[model samples]
Target: MTCKSSTTPVMGIHLHDIHSMASKLETLTKNQQLDQNDIKSILIVIDLNPEPMSIDDELESSKLTRKEFAKSIKKLAELKLIDWDFNW
Candidate 1:
């Protein structure tokens, strides 16, 4: 992901520079409604499964049931945070 500064057209924010600070931003942006555990769970699945991970796979990896993982992914999709495509 590329982060462009609003004030500077020529500058881009490097991921390494803001990587540490994004966690707090993520929490606040998620409306502070989701706890750290929830965010951690989601991140774990995303980080581990770079490919198009099936809902079942994510659930199994995160120790969450299929239903729970589905709900979380649905919310993430609604937030425009992830793009999912189904071929089958």
Candidate 2:
């Protein structure tokens, strides 16, 4: 994803850039009730799996409980950050 700043437009964001941005955002929002682990898990899943992953597979890989994973996924979806389809 390319981000446009006031000065210039960033073109072609890579995975590393996304991770860095997320980390910086997390640090900037210290008082926010955001779960760093959940963000990390989502990034890891995106990095590790090029294809769409099942909910169970993502939960197992991220080591998050069903509830936690579901919550995170819902939040991510609400933010329009991830495009996921529930086949099951």
Model 1 misplaced stretches (Cα beyond 4 Å): 1-58, 86-88
* Per-candidate local distance difference test: 0.40, 0.44
lDDT of 1 at 81: 40
Query: Model 2, range 36-73, lDDT digits (tens) per residue?
Result: 55444343223333348654575566565655544544
Could you tell me the TM-score of candidate 1? 0.34
For every model shown, the clashing-pair count is: 0, 0
Winning candidate number (lDDT): 2
- Report the CA-based lDDT of candidate 2 relative to the real structure: 0.44
- In candidate 1, how many Å is residue 48 off? 8.6
Q: Model 1: which ten-residue window has the lowest total lDDT? A: 1-10
- Model 2 segments beyond 4 Å from truth? 1-58
